[model samples]
Target: MTPTSSLKLTWSSALESGDRATDVQHKYLIEIINELAEAIETGKAGQSIRKILNLLKQYTDWHFCREELCMERRQCPAAAANKEAHKHFMRTFDAFAEEYKVSGGSEDIAMRMYKTLTDWLVMHIQKIDTNLASCPDNGCSR
Candidate 1:
């Protein structure tokens, strides 16, 4: 789906690292976040929210593993910190998901989650993930 202004997230060149696979995954994550927002805004988020959250969690797990493997193999000095950051993100996301479940999918809660996801993603990609470009392979191709 095309990301609309209502999603409050727009991809920018600043988020790119010139790595095709990682860049594509990052963009997909953004789209998933936007999809979550759309589901909430459209009042289709009861069961759908759970599904979307699961999709996000699973994707996160896969992406982190893939990144960590590449980083470790390439001897990236930032690997440890990068893994920590990913773990922290997962923990934070889990907390939010639990809160949403407890609140019975409150709209306010959804918006809060949306904002958190959007902000965290943009910052993490720009600040943390960009460092992946410095790996021994120069693009984490290892």
Candidate 2:
């Protein structure tokens, strides 16, 4: 990977979830992903990558739970799909983290992880999570 490429995730209009809190959380997720990309691009070691992964995992869990609960309470139509998508992301992320741990995290795995993360979040936000916009409390106050 070319460290000079300046890989990063930028928030766009399409990412708007119409919910203040959720949108903020999504933005933070993008920030975390960008941080990981920067780390990889700069040739940071496995431990640093692991720390970012851990942070991602924790924040994702919290955000997903809040969002899911809000959707469910609001009787949003896309709640189930959102939860399922979140589960899929967790599994995929865990697998990536595990692979990096086993292989000591080469640039190849790092790039793959970075790509997978950015791709998944974009799709998830546009397709699934955005459905929450119609919910009574889109921001998932709880």
Best by lDDT, which number?
A: 2
- For candidate 2, lDDT tens digit of each residue in 23-119? 8899898888888977887788454888898899999999999888877877889989989999999999999989998997788898898999889
How many steric overlaps are in each model, in order?
0, 0
Model 1 agreement with the true structure over 24-121: per-residue lDDT tens digits: 88888877888888887787776578888989999988988887777787677777988999999999999999999998887777888888888888
- Flag regions of model 2 displaced more than 4 Å: 1-6, 45-47, 138-142
- RMSD of each candidate relative to the true structure: 2.1, 3.3
- How good is model 1 by TM-score? 0.87
In candidate 1, list every pair of residues with a backbone clash: none
Q: Scored by CA lDDT, what does every candidate get?
A: 0.80, 0.83
Give the TM-scores of the predictions, in the order they appear: 0.87, 0.90
